[model samples]
Target chain A: MSPLQTTWHHIRRSPFQSLIATTAMFLSFFFISTFIIINSGLSTVLKYFETKPEITLFLKDGLDTATVENLQKDLSSYQGIKEITFISKEKALTIYKEQNKNNPLLTEMVTASILPASFEITVSEPEVLEKIYQNYSTKTNVIDEIIYQKDIITSLLNWTNATRQVGFAIILIIASISFLTMITIIGMKITNRKDEIKISRLLGASSFYVKKPFLLEGIIYGLFGSIFGFLFSFLLALIFQKSINSFFQPITFIDLNVNFYLILLFAEIITGTLLGFIASWIGAKRYIKF
Target chain B: MKIVFDQVDKKFGIVYALKDISFEIDQGEFVFLIGNSGAGKSTLLKLILNQLKPTSGKILLGDIDLSNGNKDDVNNTRRKIGVVFQDYQLISDKTIEENIALILDIVNYPKEKIQSRIDKVIKEVNLGTRRFLFPSQLAGGELQRASLARALAIEPEVILADEPTGNLDPENSWNLVKLLKDINKENNTTIIMTTHNNEIVESMGKRVIKINDGEIVKDYNISKKS
Candidate 1:
């Protein structure tokens, strides 16, 4: 019989054993793929917040043009400031009107004289916002009130880090469990086929030849497990895509296309195959003897 | 292929399984290794199979040193010989035909000729009709024949029957021995049969090497009938 036929025969003879092994592998890869999607979503949300304007400095009225230009240059020279956009009072009024365009009363009430000119500053890192706030908060002559969302950004970063750490720990535990499950199942198979192995060895079969079917069995379990796991994960992600997108409103955090999912599926297959190979190698090494 | 055991000694934790054993069987010779249980007959066969390394001496098969050869050498030596066990050792889940095919597959026999070879050996052992039956469905004698067919499928230079008839009835034992004798004469294959049945040994009138307590006590050949 061919190696594939032998592997299939072994699987057919003990279907319950094969099911248990494949199910264990499926659960592991499912969690792993889910974690990857969630982690990617979290990173997207973090990036959205990090790139937004964190600090907006309202300028004092009647400030000279040269002073404003010098202030712009000074802020530009700051180490971590990524961008500094000077919004005139007219531009601010225009922004307000555009934002409230649906309400005629609100649009009519806003004017250039009433709106404050501002400097919107974005930093490369969230921690840089604190330093800029501390250094520029004391400048009351050129700055009216400094507004920044330091607390919200800091909290978001902390939560993302915590979730990632916890998720990684869980994945590690699940991966280890999957590996052990494969080892135990394959080892049990070897034990059950002790007589067959002995007889084969006595018939002049090489060690590799005797173990070929078992190694192929392991690969089969891993390959099918990973494929099914990826399918389930993809289905779940599709089911929750709308909810996730609305939750992170305007960020499009979970806008994954079919190509991306296909890549993930490929990656999962490689991982599962590698895991199966190593586990089966260890199993065969521990049990198979001449 | 001839097998040579040169002053071989096998010790298991200071207890001698086989001690100072020296013997040589020429090519195509049929010899009976007669011994009781624990007389080191299995150990001697293991030495020939390269399953057990001699503690103090060398074993050579056709110039390949089994005692000190590499893994490939040992495997090559084993591939040149076939083994039959007392319990028939057929895989329970496979049919008799599959059991024979498995050996051919393991030896990397020509894929195109595998079916023909299986048919030839199965027919030789008179198991052609029962080729599709599993081991559990076959009677004791049939199982032994299936095992013998599996051994013959390899077309080995040597056939080692370790108590092949130990579980058979007297009539079945005689039949199996006759089959072995016919195979020996036809194929000129070396046959080493281990047995305690003195009646079969006396009636066969073939070469006999008797072992008692890990030592060779008797070596003789009876003249054949005209």
Candidate 2:
């Protein structure tokens, strides 16, 4: 019989053992893939927020066009400033009217003279946001008020970092457990077939010949585990895509395409297979005597 | 291929499992290794199989020195010899045919010839009808025969039957012995059978090497004596 055929025979003979091994691997890979998806989504949301206008500097009520133009030029010359847009009072009033278009009373009440003109500044990095805010906050002569979502951005960053650290710890713990479970399962199988191994050796079988089936068996378990794990995560993502998108409104947080998922699946499969190979190698080496 | 043991001594810690054992069996020779329990017959077989390295002296299978050979050399030596154990060590999960096929597969036998070869050996052991049966489904005698068929599947230069009939009834034992003799005559395959059964030994009139306390007590040909 071929090594594959032998492995299949062994799995068939011990379905419960195979299932236990596959299940352990499945749980580990499931958590790993879920963590990846969630972390990716969080990163997407953070990126969307980071790229938005970081600081909005509202000007003094009677600032002239030249004064606003000078402010725009000054902001443009600042380091880490990606873009600086001068929103005139008329433009601000137009935005207000558009935002409240459903309510005629709200739109009719807004006028260009009442609306404050502002400079909407986009920074290249989150680190630069606080610096710009500090520099403009003291300029009350030309600036009426400075608005920047520094606290929200800081909190979002902290949450993403925490999720990554905790997710990584969980994956490491579960992966180690999964690896040990595989070794124990394969070791038990070897122990049960101790006599058969001895007989095969006595019959002139090589060590490779005796070990190949076990390694293949481990690979099979890992392959199935990773494939099923990927499928489960994919299905969950599909089911919750709309909710997740709405939760992070306008961000398109979970917009992964089929190609991206295929790549992730491939990576998970490789990891799972490598884990199985190493675990089985250790198990076979530890137990089987030539 | 011939097997030669030149003053081989196997020591496990302070005790000697075999001491200063020397013998040579020519190609195609049929020899009975007669010894009582704990007489080191198993140790001698292990030495020939290269399962245990000799503490001192040498063992040679053909030109390969088993005493100091590497793993590849040991495997190469083992490939030339087929072993049948007293327990009829057939894999319990596999059928008789699969058990035979497994050995053939291990030897890297021609893939196309494997099925035909398995059939020939199963037929030789008179297990053609029971080839599809697992070891658990077979009787003791049939299990031993399946083991024999597996041994034959390798087409080995030497066949080592280590107390193969130990668990069988007298009739089964005689039948297995007769089968071994016929195989020996037909293929001219070197046969080394270890047994404590004096009746089989006396009836066969073959060469006998009697071991006692890890030493060779007697070596003679019964046919010549008669």
Query: B1-226 in candidate 1: lDDT tens per residue?
Result: 8889899999999899888898899988999999889999988988898878899998989989887898888887888898888888899999999999999998899999999999999889888789999999999999999989998998889999999989999998999999999989999999999998988888888999999889888889977654
Go through the candidates in order and give each one's DockQ. Answer: 0.70, 0.74
State each candidate's clash count.
Answer: 0, 0
The worst-scoring run of ten residues by lDDT in candidate 1 chain A lies at A246-255
CA shift at B184, candidate 2, in angstroms? 1.5
Taken over the whole model, the C-alpha lDDT of each candidate is 0.89, 0.88
TM per candidate, chain B: 0.97, 0.97
Which ten contiguous residues of candidate 2 chain A have the minimum total lDDT? A247-256
**Candidate 1 CAPRI level:** medium
Candidate that scores best on DockQ: 2
Which residue pairs collide, candidate 2? none
lDDT of 2 at A214: 96
| Model 1, residue A145: C-alpha shift (Å) | 6.7
Residues B1-226, model 2: lDDT tens digits: 8899999888889988888999999988999999899998988988899888899998999999987788888887888888888888788888888888888887889999999999899888899899998999999899999988888888888988999889999999999999888888888899999998998999898999999988999999986325
